[model samples]
Target: MPGFVGAVQIMNIGSSGVFHIGDVFQLTPISTAKTFAGAGSFNTGETLTIRNHQSATNTFDNDGIDQGNNFNL
Candidate 1:
């Protein structure tokens, strides 16, 4: 069987807000930083789904990344 991933909700409180996916979440103020702090663990060969808050559509699918590969920082 295949594993599964779900949608993520991110809110922008600042004017220069931009969303990103990373191995872990970061508290830095850098705009080019890759943070995955909110990510969870998952198994291999998993089917992951990523969606945007603005639209009710899924943006990414079957990312093929292991749960331990990266954090949602």
Candidate 2:
């Protein structure tokens, strides 16, 4: 990918389901919700930060996440 910068930065995440890192998310004109390939659970409205995106694995790193930190995709 030309001019590829880094992993995407996400913040202030809240979901009705147990949406966690690694799980792909979707944003539509209606609302936001977890899509395919999610493997974490959390209480409603539990905010989390994820790094190290692996689309093939369909997961991301949720450990030791810093809001401003970035990792390879």
Q: For candidate 1, lDDT tens digit of each residue in 2-71? A: 4455898766567546555555446444343333332332324668675444534343547755345244
Which lDDT tens digits does candidate 2 get at residues 1-73? 2354467766655542333345345623333333445434332455766543643435555675534313311
Clashing pairs in 2: 22-59, 22-60
- Candidate 1 runs further than 4 Å off: 1-5, 23-73
Residue 70, candidate 1: Cα error in Å is 33
Q: What is the TM-score of each candidate against the true structure?
A: 0.18, 0.16
Runs with alpha carbons beyond 4 Å of true place in candidate 2: 1-45, 57-73
Q: In candidate 1, where is summed lDDT lowest over 10 consecutive residues?
A: 34-43
